[model samples]
Target chain A: MHHLRTALLGVCLLSPLGAHAYSVYVSSEKDNSITVVDGETLEVRQVVPVGQRPRGIALSKDGESLYVCTSDEDHIEVLDLKSLKVDHTLPSGPDPELLALGPQGRFLYVANEDDNMVTVVDVDKRTKVIEIQVGVEPEGMGVSPDGKWLVNTSETTNMAHFIDLSTHEVVGNVLVDQRPRVAQFTPDSRQVWVSSEIGGTVSVIDVAKREKVHVITFAIPGMRKELIQPVGIRITDDGSRAFIALGPAARVAVVDTKTFEVEKYLLVGQRVWNLAFAPDQSRMFTTNGVSNDMSVVDMERLKVLKSIPVGRLPWGVVVGP
Target chain B: MNPAMSRSSDWIRILASLSLILSIGLVRAEPLSIPIGLISAERAEYIPLSSLEPRIEDEGLEGARQGILDNNTTGRFTGQSFDLLPVTLTSDQSPSDVVRDLIQRGVRLFLVDLPAADLLELADLPEAGDALLFNIGAMDDDLRTQGCRSNLLHTVPSRAMRADALAQYLAWKRWMRWFLVVGPLPEDRAFGAAIERAAKRFGAKIVVQKPWTFKAGASRTDSGHFNEQQLANSFTQVEDYDILLVADEADAFGAYLNYRTYRPRPIGGTQGLVATAWSGVTEQWGATQFQRRFLERTGRFMTPRDYAAWLAVRSIGEAATRTQTGEVSRLRQYLLGPDFKLAAFKGVPLSFRDWNGQMRQPILIVSPRILVSVSPQEGFLHQFSTLDTLGYDRPETECSIR
Candidate 1:
């Protein structure tokens, strides 16, 4: 809109120090590069060329560095958060698509899409400590609230494997609906919700017994569960609300955490992919892969307030300090 | 004394035989060494279907192994000896290791059963010059698309080629509208996307898409699972849809969507209207001899995969046979050239695309029960056979190495 014409010149002239202390990294799957954006300014600052196809991005908790798994490269690249230089590299299991970092960023759990295993990396040592076998084509991974259990979702097998964090062995498994993509536990850590992208439902399981107690399905007539394709679900820190990036339909669905009901759909950019919340959970950012842009959803207003242009096929987005 | 004399005679005969064997082996063992390189996945110790519920005719890797042996015997009978040098790749290993191992073994061709990227890695390698790759199981259309390589020859049809064959016959039936039910897997969607493309090209519209969810342990009692009553009451309302297109490539729940389809609709995508290579009825048009020979050799029915294996050997034989000049370079040139064609009984004479090395053939749309139709409808035409209409042609392909 050229609304920031004067402000842009001021920023270009270095009139004020950038307030964007935290950087947002968008892994562009199509273009095969990582676009670094200033979270506050929403300006695409730099593009870092990486491997063949970059899908997942995770920042170190202390904001010292970032890790990206380029699927085709078959390795994870470590980028210094301040210098934005690829400093260290570590071997990951093949075709890593999603990553779940342990609490305090000591260990990184990577879901290798092609291998059907989860690689546990000691980030400090820059080495893979152990790789635990999981279900077929593990697509999503999440650590428990207390970081006791690492849940990895296998898309084809339609199951969630619970790995004991200390032992790094698959302790248990819970069968869910078809194409389960993401695994997340509620704030209380009593329940684990696994989203089935194709099965068109989320299976909420009891963490203790590892049994599925509830299956959540949407009743949007004329839309097939396979096509509805839920991916990258984020529940609020308070655990009252959840936002799911629904594929093909190009919308972010808001769900009531307690009721497990889809409350509403927030129209986002095309192919609304992975999303991340602001530190306070006041806003949500999604990388719209098809439209090559980012959709900024105001969580308080429950609406997509703006769409910012990005690189080709913005896949995984990260919002953190 | 007579027994000792007899024993001494026996030793003389044995000694003479041993000398003869030693002298004969020296010449016979001279290095006319034939080398064959095999690229396969890690050896699997446990088999699910075979271990859990063994079938009279298996459907898993065991079946593939048996089919390979059947075709290998045929190759052996023709005097082409293959010593398998199998290199297994795990999720952690680098694929370039395969290229190096094959080179060390003096392997000129590779029977590749790896992912597309791994195949590409070998093709792109500078040291992998003059090496030919035969794709056994990569069904991704993109491998035939932008990733096509000159040195690679696909024995398996691209996913779209097989999917489109089924769609065309259904379209001919005036199945103007389809209720496209796709599976959740990305691979299925990729194949389904090709079907969707074919449907649009043939003037069929997907009116509604529904995904049936099958939970792992939530097996409904057959008391209500699929009976006449269940089928009739499966869907309360099916709107504007005449046929169902199921695209579950994993076969996870697709088999159920076929005849059990609610609302009296026909299944098209994965189940009812299927396009494939080398169906048993494909023998109807003089393929009877092929079916007989294959069946007799294996003592089992032929699968689509078995045909690909057969075609790979036959293509090489046909190329070698047709070339009167017995030069290895000339034979290789004939196969890699654009003009070479083989009568694989897949329908019209098939040839390699040269660009990505995928075979072009008329796909047979058939079911386990019967043959439905042939794709590249009678009137449709391409420079090659209408089968070229199934997958990417020269202009649209992104394969760079070719």
Candidate 2:
């Protein structure tokens, strides 16, 4: 049973079909390109050009399709992993920054940074179906697995807008720290952690009760809030740990999920912005902006194992099974 | 030695070693002391030498420097210190040259008040990659558009930044119709062109363009001087223009067009509805401390040049505080990080464009006596700040500085 569990966890990603089908995808806001790296080799494989000022990336739950939000394009590009071809474009809100797929994989929620609106698109149809207006500069979005709550963050207001998936109505509003971006839920959906990029803190909120339970502030001071701006947040599949991308620190912070405490810092390349973990859970990769590289971390040791030079200003990453 | 005594001595040695190791551990655990560098011109520019024996000018730079000093002091109780290195250079020197020279001096954060070409020159030098340039001057609107560079960060308001401010208020006032009056001087023409661009960008109309000619306290052979009624009657044919925009940069005619017009209308030029780099009224509204510091330090009034100088120094402090290292490379990383933002007296925070390295923030509008308003209006908002809405939107930007 022990071997079986390990095999299920590790071999799931080593499958013959999923292999070579999709490389690691990352978005570069500076170069306006998406870099793909071979998951197994951890080597930069290809660089594909995209719309003006590309920023956010989202892979379909099935891992066959990936969606990229271009800030200047006012549209989302859908890519088919099998053919590695640009599938189509869907009209999006202006200046899209971050996005996520709904639990059912039927819809994509795009955070339009400039328009202060969240655009919802039906993935199958590749069409924008609904536009929900939020606060100023709406960015970073996540939906509960049960499709009960849709939470989005407003950077300027430093608050989270929570809407009911069923009613499509704003359920409640909770103030987080300053300039909140990027959010993630625990495996069981018991908690939601949102990274306040400008505030340099992460607010871990209770999903069921919809309130902030704890705020993880970096112990160091004098570091500009920009240096502590937390851009990415990810929880382990087992919900035992969480990882946050520290923008100016150029590294990833490991937090123990149970204690809600920052456990350690794993140094990456320069200006680490966003990251993703391999499906096997053996490694995690981050896009380093200034260094123009991708940092591969050996998760077991909680250290940056290697750095892969990539296209200019690598800002987003998504790993596929 | 006795056996018991020898054992005691050995224990003491071990304790000493342990204590040494523990102290080292404590030092590492404590917060780090970081160094920051402020790079500017080691020499000054000749700006027509307005005042006698004028060595210091730049009020805007002074305001920015004071803002950083005040903000960084907040970190003292929290354990952060700031050190500034003041540099000034002549126009003959290259900005990249100065930037490299400062890197050798342990300077990595740069605040710039230079020509755009000089700013782009930062990319040519070998060590230029190591430092961050905070742009505080050279208000060409194109810097945020086609001329953007990643190595440079802008804090000083661009011409468009100010124009956007003017547009927002004008739009709110429903002053859609405009009567364009242009002066001949370069400064006058440039300002008028910017105002015209803003008029179009914010849904305004240009009913007519009137050319004004004056020799600065001298005119034609006629005996008439500062003819208010004749100048006002120039607009008699077109009663359609709502606001008369004078672009008399030479202060030749625009200064008097206000209220002296044939009809009761708003006159905006070098006088009414004007845009400038820095305003004296800025002394109020959180700008008092900046004024105080400049007066205390230099015993003179602050100028726009001073604001640029201050922003240069402050950018270094911000970068140094974040990376907690005096090293140039680390400072660059921290300075460009998305979380890296700067707050100035302009009442908003400025952040760098990772692609272009332009500091994006608000631009203030000042009437002769008061700070009238800020651009993009309160309602115009972006994901970052509503103040950003006034400047170039990401989608409209053509700066491909990656």
Candidate 3:
């Protein structure tokens, strides 16, 4: 069934409208390159080589440039969308693994896995604004939609630190679970979902109270409990649904926001690490590290469309016009 | 003259009382400091057979230090602080005296990296009655059974657990036949006995069992390779078997028997493929970042002993973080309670056994350079946890910790 849909999509891409289709950019950690895939055709467009170990990629708010975290080289490489070439480098403190752009897209919050600090860099100026000290081994970064807060999840400390934008200090902290890999705020900015990779649970924290409101656990029949590691999390723009990427389980759990219950599991590639949605929210793309491919999901149907081979150890993804 | 002098002294006493009251209020406003003591003894260093292996001066101490750093990171937000006070015993120093001094200093949590005898001596001290000791070095099975103490908890895996872990994997591979080779040392014999128990429990047969009595000479000399090769070949010539199960914990001849066995069988015991709590080759389940952090901090690969020491300190940190107290009684209750579970880079949460005070954890079946599998291998299940299958279960435990 998926192969037939992929074949139909390929046929549709041959139309004239597909020439102006949006592009999906994926960061490959092992290949140290950015794979450009045509959104309309679900085909590989280009494999632009970048710096060493690119894991996190973020699209600018203006949708003109892509910021790729070259973790091993301890810097962020800026790739111009037009030329698909390396433009410049931002000073990321040390071993930047994942990053999040602020709501206005002026400052980029980079999580330095080695130094346990979040480096906020000015994209326009190409300089570091400040380094906010956080817990040990910070990996995940998220910014509130209202531009009032930045949440960083430390893998070792197992806490989501709420950094006040005005003061640049950790105003509050919520202890979630072990080895939190992602901190994602809801569209309404009232709650944040933190994924614990080892604890195998997702904790929902109330933004106002800075306290955990609910804990979401997953249980799959005939599957070992340890393999249900929750990593990447994405909530729809309407805040009605959520998609959680279960690492090494090869499944993405579809959760309803209202009841906070899992509705279904969509099978994806192996070791799915992160995911991103298209501009219209009609489709989703996931980076599967072990399989070296990206699984495209038809969001409306809640089914996997196809898996497109990309590069070795694909870690992060972002869609751009 | 006497009246004036007495009036001045009365004013001084009142002023001192006022200052004491203000200082008490200030101290109460500060964060509570929890100091944990780490006691270990120096031993004669033995050179490893492989030059790639590093000779570390602070094997377990570095792990304890890393644990303290990790605890402090969490403590920053919790409004608590942790400190590690370590003492390395010399040739003439006694462990009991050190325990007494630490107890007097009001340290209630201790991580001891000593042999079973010295660990028991410190646990028996009257001054340590209110203190809790974590064994991070000893792996003797007796310490978990008949020699258990009420106040002592073991973070290190026992020999029986390691043996069972290996046996389960071997059984899964259907390697039923075995040629067992035991070393001459007492520790080797104890390990060999555990292997025997595991073979019986897991439904494997030992085809031929023999003791290795060869005395190895200087291994770095020009003629060392020839002599060692001949010794391993002659010692391993036995009846037909699937694999050679060796018990050489002292590292005397196990490494030499890797490819020198007469029957061309695989080695599975303490040498070629071993079961341990932790190894450098283990990098899954978020252990890669942990290995990187440890390497950047200590410039050495983490050993099993280091991991045990780290687990000991992290266990206390987990307890104190949950209970928010430095009091001995409260932390002890919290650690042993059902609410306690530690995330130590393993795939699952590790907890202590109520019957024996031994920790329940998954054993890593690793070769020297890669991880083969983790046991409590699939299909080996217990009524409670699958980890219970790797060690002494509750019904089989002889320990009665009150």
Candidate 4:
């Protein structure tokens, strides 16, 4: 009887339908909902109604809770991952757009775009810890891998401010291209990358020196310079390649991390805003804000395998098991 | 050593390290202040014709003030600060003397809000040799064409650009024939010339051209409103045309022709549907925040002059931040350099045309209520950039300034 049961389990694991093990959650800015997709199969499982103006999203460190920045409501909604429901609300400052998790998920750094401040929330206590004043129209938030520094990018100010985690104070600020929308820390925590939407350049900052070390520019055949706006940046966990979503250009540029050169531009959906990776890093998904769908790309072949309809004006995406 | 004494010594060591780190941080942050000058000739008090038009008190100065605040926000992070030195000269005061005094006071970047003639006088001053002058008020096409100055960059669109912007929209709408009405003013005649030039360039036919000689009615009272309709009706009776284009730079009888024109043709050019560099109706491309901030700051709407002045100051601020210096020559070179682009809440990054020193931007076509369209319209292409299609392209420019 044990041999027969083991053989049956092995057969089930080899089947195609059994490969859907991951889930992708996307925040829709217009529809005010979170669309959940079966990561592997590219199927929409549910469209969970969220707060007003759901934009930036991030999963908890343990992947058990999801936080959605409801910019219109001026609050962060904590959604229960297991039950797929709003567990509670955390206090965010005015007009929260994007957020990042501090070291060990101890603090949630939320960028209040209108107020020009970053609201640091104590995740476990569900309380507002502090608000650090930053530059004008702060949008992007990034925490170093070691959790020692938090970087906030302001659009109008055209700068990336580095806040010390221990002191919760800004220790340094690095200027970048115009209207930087997102900042990402490499997995190894040696460098920080920022994508400027209007400037059309990605600035790589040396973490220790706190200055721009390199600037990556993108060019696509037959595309105008104004349309090649670099918005979302995601460096793979292995630190070998970085994927950047060029907003309004409808393409993603895959850059080699070691060489700092653009290897290829993968055509995606229109006005892509953000991207997420499967837990195993074998697949990637991009939220197309204008097209109202998500493009699922196969990492191995560097091709968009399918696009699944999600919600209106999808802004951000995050994946979990 | 004794245990208690050793513990006290360790405390002192820790405190020493803390103070050392704090001192290093302080030494690293040396703030630099960049002083900018605002030069404008004092104007007579502007009185509106009616209550419908709100009197703008701080037209150009308020915009510069707001721009200073914006620059400082970024400057605080970059260890740089911007200071505005505004000097409004009286009619009797010499612009050369004022500019020399400013240079003595260590001011290099200037925002000049003066008429075309006064601007040329200021630009010709020897004391203004090292200063980078930004023209935010003058709209004369000659300043951008044959009379262009190397040191001056005009933020305000030239008359030709505005005329071309309107002409492109009309062409896109297939309104190929136009009836032109010129007002009774020298500036109005200049605008009329620009309109005719734009029509010729855009392949439009001016079926008939006439001058508006009707006396403007004082429509502030009930009796005045009674004769306004009749006066406007008689003023607009012209030959067959698709659109009635008016050149009323004086704003005398433009508003009255909106609903009172014969044949019910849509009015454009200086009234009704108009093309402007900036408008209060625009809310796209993250401009709502700017509008809200301006409203909160001044308790009034932003005018075109205010927007132009703001952009002038912002250009200086952006150049200063990028070059990391307040030196006038360096900032000027960076501005005219090919890599210079300023994101001024427009969909596209704005840059200066090297030939004419005019900032190339997409003009907004607005109705009274909402923004209708943005020009440099579809199918209007340039060899380099679509923005070049709006104004005098490189080949057509006659500017001799180097």
Candidate 5:
């Protein structure tokens, strides 16, 4: 099926400007490098060596700088998008695992797993703003689209902490399932989806009421429930569809946002950890840690197009325009 | 209307309003306190054969402390507080006396790290009738079966569970034949019996069974390697087998069988590759952060005993947080109920088996350097949870806790 799609696209690619040329950056945890693939061609473009235990990659607002969380080094390495070189370091607290940008992309919220605190960094000024004390082993960070709230999910504490951006205080705490790994807010900021890796459920919390409105569960026939660990959630901009990376299950669950039900499960590489979307949202890229590869999925068809080999322990990924 | 009647009514209303305010103030002044007692009896320390194993002084206690820290992190939001009151008993001290004192001090939750005998003694104490006890050290299968106590819940995996976990993995790898070597200790024989049971349960065959009668020489002596090598080779000269299963719970000769066997067969059970609830080699499913936190707190690798103790305390914490009460009966009911599940970085939510009071958890199969696999292995199905395949299931449970 992938070959047939490629052949059809080959005939349509006669025009030079037929597709968008975005770059996908994947942070390899073991190799200490970033695997950059061309989004248009779906091929490995470069492997840029970075700091130790690089994870949690995110593109800047202007898409000029890419922030990489060097967890072992205890800092965020800023890579220049064009040069693919480390520009400088930002002071992140100990063992930063996952990160998110503020609505304006002026500040970065990093979940410091070791310290149980979320460190907010002023990206432009390259200075620490303040460290907000959160639950134990904070790993997920999500900023509300309206810029009013930031949700950080702590894996051990098993709670989604809603922080008020204005005061930077935990305004509300909603207990989710066990080992909550990722938090993603809806495009309209009405609800936030939190994935519990060990509990094997995704909790959808209402923003206004600060309560769990519904829980979306995944069930692939013949798959053990323990293997279906939900992690690394990506919701579309229109809030119509959501893709959840099921770790160790080696599948991405596509959910219909309106119904909060699983639409389909697309099989991918082994141990898919995190994912990214192209600038145009037409393609998706997933980092498979055990396979040491990135799986490219066509957004419209919800099909895995190909698996491109990457560095060892591919962890986090992001796309740059 | 009479003035005297109106003044009497006003006085009643004022007193009622004042009492309401006082009750509200009292409620605001105190949070629900869940005090857990950790009672451990001191035992003779055995020097580990390998330098990789560090001698930890506060094994179970440190894990309970970390559990308190984790519980309080979530408790701060739920208007609850958790405290661990630990008492380590000397050889001369009595566990019954400790339980009496703790019960008098209003501790209804206990994490017991004593041997099976001492644990049973504490549970039988009249003062502990209302207390809920969690066994963190003992692994005797009989405790979960014929010797089961209605009040006792076990966090440590039983001998049968560990044996069954290993058997499942071996069956998955098609290593169906095992050469069994049993040590002289009673605990070793019990473990050997469990292996026999597991072999029958998992469709494996024990090709040859031999008892290890050679008394180990002074291992620390300069020329000890010569004696150790000969002893390991002499007893392991049996017929060909897929693996050598050693039952050495006392750490006597299990480590010696590695690389010194007559054949090049892999060693398993209490030796080369171990089936345990936790290990240093486990780093998946967010366990790296769990290990890092433990190392940062104790400056040592978390052991199996530590993980068990942590689970015991966290189970209570989880129950308290969910039920919003510290009452012994209510908490116990909530724990054994269907809604109780605690995550211990094992890639699954662990809960108690209502039939046997044993925790349903996946067992880790690990070597000295890396994790081999986790069981219940694939295709080992249970009507309820696949984790049940690693231990005694409901139908096989001899415990009847009403």
Candidate 6:
């Protein structure tokens, strides 16, 4: 499927403007480094040292700079893609765990895990636009495809807060499973999937109704139910399939988007934390925290192709061209 | 029939039909009320010389209250309503009597924060045979071993668990040489024995063992600072050791050992780098959220006992959510079964040890200002769970109850 998507994307986007190599960037929590891996060869390209306690990573729309959340320093550092150096810092509120950029890449929404607020930064102005108070320990941030709403999931509050982009206010709040870690909006913006690490379930919320539509639970053969903690979620561009990173189970569960049923579980490295897809969508990279490595999964084969060793406690991954 | 009488009868008929439909809807959507009972002593006696420790009027009860709020928040969507029936007993009152009253009132789930003897008294009642009790205050290992009850689940970490957790960190640091200093109490001696067992289990050595006979002097008073340094330094004179592991369950003379010892060694076990369930300094793995919630609710930091109690109540809520029933028997069976797991901000899903009914979790080792580490340290592997390495595993269990 991934190969087909890449082929289709190549045929549709084949031009001089589309010719660019892809690289996967991973944030290592303990080692304080962002490891760069070539998307095609699956090799370590470079290891760039960043600030203290770097956990979340996001790339600019044009792929010129990478925004890294240095949680301990209570700020977000921008790394120049060409120089591979942190050139500037954004004043994100205390303890930013994860972040999401607006569709147009004008504003950056950061989840301040320690402060329980979402800091929206106007990227062009290089200033914080607003700090919206949210539920306790807001960690996951997601923006709708249409750029109308942003979703923030609070860990202890157990609610998915929907903030309207225009008003910068929480428009709707949907109660989800316990300890929601990641929220991902569907490509159509009709639904949002929030992964609950402690509840061991994924809550799919209907955006229009602002309520939970389905609760997807993963069950792996010979694995304990508690170990099936769903953390990172990624939906295919066409909204046909979803991949969920099961934290301690060390596997990625593939679910059919239409039916909401789990199709397969692919074994990965130890303590998988987050997932990212290559620009071409032909492969997925997973940060395995315990194994201190990243697993490359072939999207078409639905199998782990290789595990490349990274920094200590690899947390989040992002792919850019 | 008269025209006026017929018009009035038509209006009455419409009103009667609407009322019947509304009554049916109410019956169909009736919420399931799950009542949990909390029993603890009315007052917590303050320990002298600890000026930094604030006087918390309600520690365990406040934590359970927060848990109740959390449960109701999630339970609102699941059609479950959780109610906490907190019954505080005076020193003169009998704990078993309260247990009987709560059982009669339809509270089959309980969180008890009493001493070991009082907890046993409540658990051994005939009327409470079917009740599920959660031990949140007592850290006695016997409760999980020989004295384990079929109906009681201990959320508190046993002394052996803490000892093992600290031992793993010490062993990982290559601090194999320990100077064991025990206080003058029976419980302290038992804790000393647990430390000894941990040293043997983790391949460490207790270079010297001694008991502190000096009385705990008063703090911030006359003669309080007099002879304390001399006494502690004289008592700590022994073979060179990497750390001084104190077994002071009574809180007597342990705090004095820090900075007053003859040799410069890090004090651990009961002081300095102590292993606990929750610490004020732990901000990782989303604990900041819990700490913030707790601080907002109670206006203070959450203690270990409070976290244990909170976990106990949340366990019931999680079980109810999973089973979708408030029936005590079904919930008990499901919780004791191998399938039950609760997420309590410990970075892992916490579950019960089926053999001993002890909640298996990661013990946080913290100093005064920062979180030192969490143990069942690296390279300590178990065939089943790494958390089982900190406590009594299946093979080491004397608990016969399934």
Strongest candidate by DockQ: 4
* Model 1 lDDT per residue over B176-273, tens place: 78787777888778877887887777788888876655432112555534443453346414786887778876555555555555576666666566
Ranking by TM-score: 5, 4, 3, 6, 1, 2
Share of reference contacts found in each model: 0.00, 0.03, 0.45, 0.45, 0.62, 0.28
Error of 3 at B342 (Å): 2.3
Residue pairs in collision within model 5: none
Q: Which candidate, 1 or 4, has the higher TM-score?
A: 4
The CAPRI class of candidate 1 is incorrect
Candidate 2: C-alpha lDDT: 0.68
Candidate 5 local lDDT, B257-351, one digit each (tens): 88999999899999898999999899987788889889987999999999999999889988887787889899888888877878887878899
**Chain B TM-score, all predictions listed:** 0.76, 0.73, 0.92, 0.91, 0.92, 0.91
lDDT of each residue in A1-321, candidate 3, tens digit only? 123234435544774763846788999989999999988789898999999989989987667689999988889999999899999999999888899998877899999988889999999999999988888889889898888989999988888988888778777778877789999999889999999887789999999988899999998876677678899999998999999999878899999988999999999999899999876689999999899999999999998999999999999999886
Displacement of residue B89 (Cα, Å) in model 2 is 42
- Candidate 6 lDDT: 0.86
> Candidate 1 or 3, higher lDDT?
3
Residue-level lDDT for A294 in candidate 6? 95
Compare the candidates by TM-score and give the number of the best one.
5
DockQ of each: 0.01, 0.02, 0.30, 0.38, 0.34, 0.21
Candidate 1 lDDT: 0.68
Q: What is the per-residue lDDT of model 2 for residues A189-209, given as tens digits with 9 covering 90 to 100?
A: 777889876567899889877
Error of 6 at B164 (Å): 2.0
Clashing pairs in 4: none
Error of 3 at B72 (Å): 1.1
Query: In candidate 3, residue B225 scores what lDDT?
Result: 86
User: Could you give candidate 2's per-residue lDDT for residues B62-132 as a string of tens digits?
Assistant: 55556455434422322344555545666576666666777787665666655677766774466866656
Better by DockQ, candidate 5 or 1: 5
lDDT of each structure? Answer: 0.68, 0.68, 0.87, 0.86, 0.88, 0.86
- What are the per-candidate TM-scores when only chain A is compared? 0.91, 0.91, 0.94, 0.94, 0.94, 0.94
What would the per-residue lDDT of candidate 4 be over residues A64-95, giving only the tens digit for each residue? Answer: 78999998899999999779999999999887
Query: All predictions: root-mean-square deviation over Cα?
Result: 25.8, 21.5, 8.2, 7.3, 9.2, 9.0
CAPRI tier of model 2: incorrect
